[model samples]
Target: MPRALAARWYSDHDQYQNERRVIWGSEWLMFGVTAELSRPGHYVADEIAGYPLLVVVDPQGELRGFHNVCPHRAGVIQWPGCGQTGNLVCRYHGWAFSWDGSLKSARDFGDSPTPDDHSLRPIRVETWGPLVFVNLDENAPALASTLGSLDTAVRQHAFTDFAYGRRLVRTLECNWKTYVDNYLEGYHVPLLHPLLNSAVDMKTYSVEVPDDTYCIHRAGQVEGSASAGVWVFRYPNLAINVYSDGMNVERIVPLSSTRTAVVYDYFAQDVSEEKIQSMVEMSNITLDEDQTIAELVQRNLDAGVYEAGPLSPRHENALAWFQGRIRQSTGAR
Candidate 1:
């Protein structure tokens, strides 16, 4: 049987630092929705892993991304969250940047203009459906290649019909991996989620890792299909779950070694407000259950009384797959 990752990987400060470098720093991360950048000068600014990110639409109607830091004294271009701006001017200082993230003017540093080399560090920005993503790693593979079969599954489900609805941010007092470990398996559903367990046939519930970068979670069968309630969890931190009328995208971001944030953006197609509210309520209910358990588990992991344990061969294969990728990425023993 495979073993769970050692507890050290969850709460250790050094291990967290290593993860920030090797895993998050190099991976393509979902940033925000494309609807937020519908017009030129509209932008979304936030931090992913450890990088302060900025994704904005230029005058040419193209999406561009940057480090969100002013090259001059490292100030922020915009306040966190979504807003429309006339230009990329540093909020702290007045340094201005061009749409391409090139240095345009240095508020009042000198008489001559600063070179483009001092511009905000540009990153890669791309969109899949309504969501936008950024990659800090200049050498990482394209989002399409990284998504692999997840793309096919998404298209098959007609997930592109989802439009940006609403977003919910939940801060949890646990390692991001702790919640992810909980997400990658269905072992606890029967014991913890009575409502969810009764709705889906547990015997048919399974998590399949068809690609190295993503996994598929299936619970029972839809009327005319092989499965229903299918969700996709991409390696490191992105999750996309599809429902009959809507979908929710999850971005599991690390605020620190011990603190994490779960950002949920809900989307729906031709669905009524009542139905959308019901779906969000269900998600919130399940989230509350998982949060309470995950926080308690995190405390135990940090209590220093445990190290590692055997993983469930039947239910936790996805956990093993996830943990193995962490080990491979971070060189953890």
Candidate 2:
């Protein structure tokens, strides 16, 4: 029988810090899609696990990533947003960086030569289909290796052809792991998500851990349903949910030991305003139901009434696999 993670694992600050150092530090994390930076000089700046990152397309039309910090005084180069510009100019010192991460100008330090050795720090970036992923640890395995069968799963679908429809962000008052725990299993669908349960065939639900770092959840489609959405979870915090009409990519960003930020980026075959609005509304209803139960579980973990429990071998193998991976990553007992 698989055992559930202890309650402390969900609420402990020190454990959370350790996880940040080990799991997030070395994992290949999905940032955004390639279409966002499709043109030369296009860029998007954001933070991943507190590490400021910038993704841009060079004059040569190649995707690149950097630390998003100016070398001179550690000033931020670009504010958090997306746009197209020839160079990344630091607002504090007017230092500019080219798309290839070379220092273009250091402005206003006469006779004090610009250090040829200094440039924007580079981060490892890669693309899988239309998605962009960056890894803090350059030594980690290639994104393809980590992705494994996920590539084959998404290949049959028109995922790359889908255009961005809408984005929904939610900050949940629970440990990041709590939300992931809820996401990795289908056991709660019948109890917590009545709408989802009515839509998916739970008896046909099955979970597969394709590799050490990801899980795939498959279930038979309900009668007359258009699609049986594919749910793929990459270790640490990335989820790709694909349906016949669209795809939803979820990033679970840990704000603190007990707080999490979840970003839902929805893309679809059709990008009409009416279709986007309908998709957003349906997604929100499903997410709201999940948020309620995840927060409630966190409250229970904090209350100290329950320390641990046994896993359901039939329904929670994926959760057990995820918890095991966390333990393996952090070397926690």
Candidate 3:
């Protein structure tokens, strides 16, 4: 049996900071969707994990990504969130930049010798299917290299039948790792999520990690009902859960050591109001259940009374695999 990650990993500020540098800093994280960045001036700006990201389509028909910050007094080229911007002008000052992040004009700093070139920092951006991803590390391998078997699993999905749905964001009041640990296992489903437990056959449920990079879940639906069809959780922050007629892509983003945010993007074959409501409600209920248990577990870990416990050899292998990846990345105990 493998032991769960130490309690300190959940509540320690230092451990959390270390993880931000080694894991989140160097990984290819999910951004927005390709459909949003369709037009030439279209852009999506948001703070992903800790990076203030801006991925915009340049006038020359190219997708460009930058840190969204201007080197001149750390001004913002665009405000937070997605929108259609006419030009790359700093929100703080009048300083403007070109699509390639080079300074185009200083507005009124005429002949002042301009402190440095005042360029926006650039980051790597790529797309897999309709999903866009950004990477902070310049030296990290391409998004394809990090995908592992997730590429095949997502590709084999019947996404052509579905249309992109709206995004639902939820914040969890616990350490990010605490929520993630709960996400990587189903041991609590029987107790925490009774509705989910009844919807699938508990006996046939299995979580397998064929590759260390991703985890796949298999279960027999109780009533030919469409639950998450190809439920795959890639290591770290991405989970693609496909159903018979719809699916929700989950992104786990850390806000701080004690807080985490989950972004759910639903896609459905049936875009009707009834179908959309049903899917959203189901996801909300499940998230509510998971959040309740995760937050309580986080509190106990912080209290220092409970150390790490033994993981079930049969059921918690996913948790072990996830924690193992953290151990390797952050060098935590």
Off by over 4 Å in 3: 112-116
Query: Residue by residue across 60-136, what tens digits does model 3's lDDT show?
Result: 86888999777878777888888787788898878877777888888878685443456788999988887888888
How many clashing residue pairs are found in candidate 3? 1
Point out where model 2 deviates above 4 Å.
Answer: 110-117
RMSD value for candidate 1: 2.0
Give the Cα error of residue 253 in candidate 1, in Å: 0.9
- Model 1 Cα lDDT, one tens digit per residue, 166-188: 77899999999999999999999
Greater lDDT among 1 and 2 belongs to: 1
Residue 196, candidate 2: Cα error in Å is: 1.5
The number of clashing residue pairs in each candidate reads 0, 0, 1
TM-score per model over all chains: 0.95, 0.93, 0.95
Better of 1 and 3 by lDDT: 1
Measured by TM-score, how close is model 3 to the native structure?
0.95
Output the TM-score of candidate 2: 0.93
